[model samples]
Structure formats: structure tokens, C-alpha cells
Target: MAECLAIRSALSSALDLGIQFLSLKTDCQVLAKAISSKRTVVEVHGVISDIFFCISQLKGFTCSFILRAANVEVDTLAKAALASYLVIF
Candidate 1:
């Protein structure tokens, strides 16, 4: 929840500054299910406490679901960032 809240806050800040029509892609099927339906189950609470917060922040954009393979570049960049953070510490 804390992690998701931080991301939601960051997204809110971006939107407040006029970010619009951005392309957001995700690879998590469960996440896709939640966003597409605008509803979640009890298990979703554990997975996405801040998802609704982020959804409210985006008023003019769309999010897409992509296969993890199709998101390899983003995956690699994220992995690199994680590795770099580890190395830095």
C-alpha cells in the first residue's frame, strides 16, 4: 500500500502539472483486470490500495495492457534501475 501510494502521489503531481493523454502500459493481468473493470475484490485491496487514487489522477489518458514480452524494453530499464539502486547502496 505504501509503495502504491507513493506511485499514485507521483502520478497525481504529474497530472496536476498538465500531463495528458499519456500512454500507460502494464503487464500484470490482475492489475489489468482491476483497471479495466474499475472494481476489485478483497484480494485486490492487498494488491492495489492506491490504484483508485491513481485512476482519479488521470482524467485524459488511457492505459493499455501489454504482454510482458512486448514490454521488454521497459522491463530492462526497470531491472537496470533496480540493479543500479542496489549497486549505489
Candidate 2:
């Protein structure tokens, strides 16, 4: 569920930036497969539709799954962002 939301947020940001092409990677296999195969599970059906709508607006898009170990940098950045957000509050 979090992965689906993150993907939606990322896509929204990219579209806002007028990005026409994108290659998105997710460490969550289910989310990755959902987007790649254009099939939605019951858990993320609504979000998947939103994601597909965003994809239609782009000239090119690809979503793939990466091993969590290979996604260390993203995890680190997310943790740092969360820490900063907590401090702000």
C-alpha cells in the first residue's frame, strides 16, 4: 500500500515537472508487477488506476522491481527525509 502511494506521488511529481520520459524502480515486487502488467490487485485497485492515468500522460514510462539491497540509497534518503520531517514537527 505504501509502495503504491509512493509511486503515485513520484509520478505526480514527475508530471508536474513536465517530465516526458521516466524509468521508475520499486523494491516492492507486487507493486512493480501491478504497474508493469497493468493489472491491479484488490488492495491497490484505485491507486493503480491513478498510476495508469499518470502513465498515459507520459510519452514513455517503465516500472521495474529492484532488490531491496540494490535500493539502499533510496532507503537512506527516505530515512533522512523522515528524520528531517520529524525534527520540523
Pick the TM-score winner. Answer: 2
Q: Residue 12, candidate 1: how far off, in angstroms?
A: 3.3
Give the alpha carbon lDDT tens digit for every residue of 45-68 in model 2: 897899999999999998889998
lDDT score at residue 74, model 2, on the 0-100 scale? 72
**TM-score against native, each model:** 0.57, 0.79
Candidate 1 error regions (>4 Å): 1-10, 41-47, 77-89
Candidate 1 at 5: error in angstroms? 7.2
lDDT of 1: 0.59
What's the TM for model 2? Answer: 0.79
Off by over 4 Å in 2: 75-89
lDDT of 1 by residue, 1-89 (tens): 22233334446677778885455576656565666676664654743556666666666656567899897776666466556556777
lDDT of each: 0.59, 0.82
